[model samples]
Target: ETFVSRMNLESHPDQPEWLSHVNASVLKVKLAMAIIGISSIHLLKTFINAGNYDIKVLMWQTIIHVVFLMSALAIALTDRLLSATHAAAKAGH
Candidate 1:
């Protein structure tokens, strides 16, 4: 909103006043995902430092990878959904 105002750009007719709040929410979600990714990296590093090939260690590693992969897939799906919505809106349909 500030940038748009500063640039003297007109806002979209359909754009909600709450759009800034929505953007903040999206930023929070992205930050959380980033923290999760960083934590997963550290977790894997910790598992590696254990230097063990036991069943428990293997299970932990597999679980971590699965969780991270799922989160990534979820993010991708969400992005696609948002992109599609934006495209539809832009097409004025």
Candidate 2:
């Protein structure tokens, strides 16, 4: 709903005044979380069927999962910092 509303507002010329204040970073964070969730599920499935996969494949999957986790953490941290900075700027004003 949030994304749909944002998209709708973006497509129209006469958007509400508050539309400018909407933080799109939240959506990015949510997407990052979803990617992490999907990566976790894939890793879990691979683990569950360990016998079907080679050890090298399992290791690679684990490495990929870790990379996804790190990427999500980086995105979340960046979003937090941006939000804090934005808030501080507003406070200064």
Candidate 3:
């Protein structure tokens, strides 16, 4: 429900003051984290049923999991950088 409200707030043109307090970068980071979590679950399930899967399938799942992790890391780092830059700019004003 909160996620849906946030999405609606982002799309609305007439945003309230509270909307300004909600950082979009934070939302992006959260979304990335959710993706990583889902990926991890899928990878874990694959590992548990390893005998049922081909070697190539296991390898691809691992590679995909690594990619999801890397993507999440990148999103978090980028959000941190943007937040720092915004803070600096505000301080300079």
Candidate 4:
């Protein structure tokens, strides 16, 4: 409502509002997935490459990595879903 009521591009290519909305939705999802995937991979490689540590230290590091990965993944996915919901609602279909 705000976009339509406030952003009237009467002379710029005449693109439908839905196109802009869907593109924003896709961009958001892609940006989120990229960030999450890269971060997860980087963290995994960091732990994997940290070899030769003592058993106790390694176990602690593993536990920490698992907890962090799960937390980050859950938060990212939840946000992705919420963004999609907003994008769909904006489409007015």
Query: Candidate 3: TM-score?
Result: 0.74
Clashing pairs in 4: none
What is the C-alpha local distance difference test score of each model?
0.69, 0.85, 0.85, 0.66
Per-residue CA lDDT of model 4 for 1-93, tens digit only, reads: 345555666567876766655654466556656666776676677668667556676677567666666765676677788878979999977
CA shift of 69, model 4, Å: 1.4
Distance from true position, residue 59, model 3, in Å?
0.9
Residue-level error in angstroms, candidate 3, position 86:
1.1
| Candidate order by decreasing TM-score | 3, 2, 1, 4
Candidate 3 C-alpha error for residue 39, in Å = 1.0
Q: Residue 37 of candidate 4: its Cα lDDT?
A: 72
Better of 1 and 2 by lDDT: 2
Off by over 4 Å in 3: 1-21
Residue-level lDDT tens digits of model 3 in 55-86: 99999999988988898899888888888998
Clashes of 2: 0
Clashes of 3: 0
After TM-score superposition, the amount by which residue 73's alpha carbon in candidate 1 deviates from its true location, in angstroms, is 2.1
Error (Å) of candidate 3 at residue 77 is 0.6
Off by over 4 Å in 2: 1-22
lDDT of 1 by residue, 51-70 (tens): 65677876776687678767
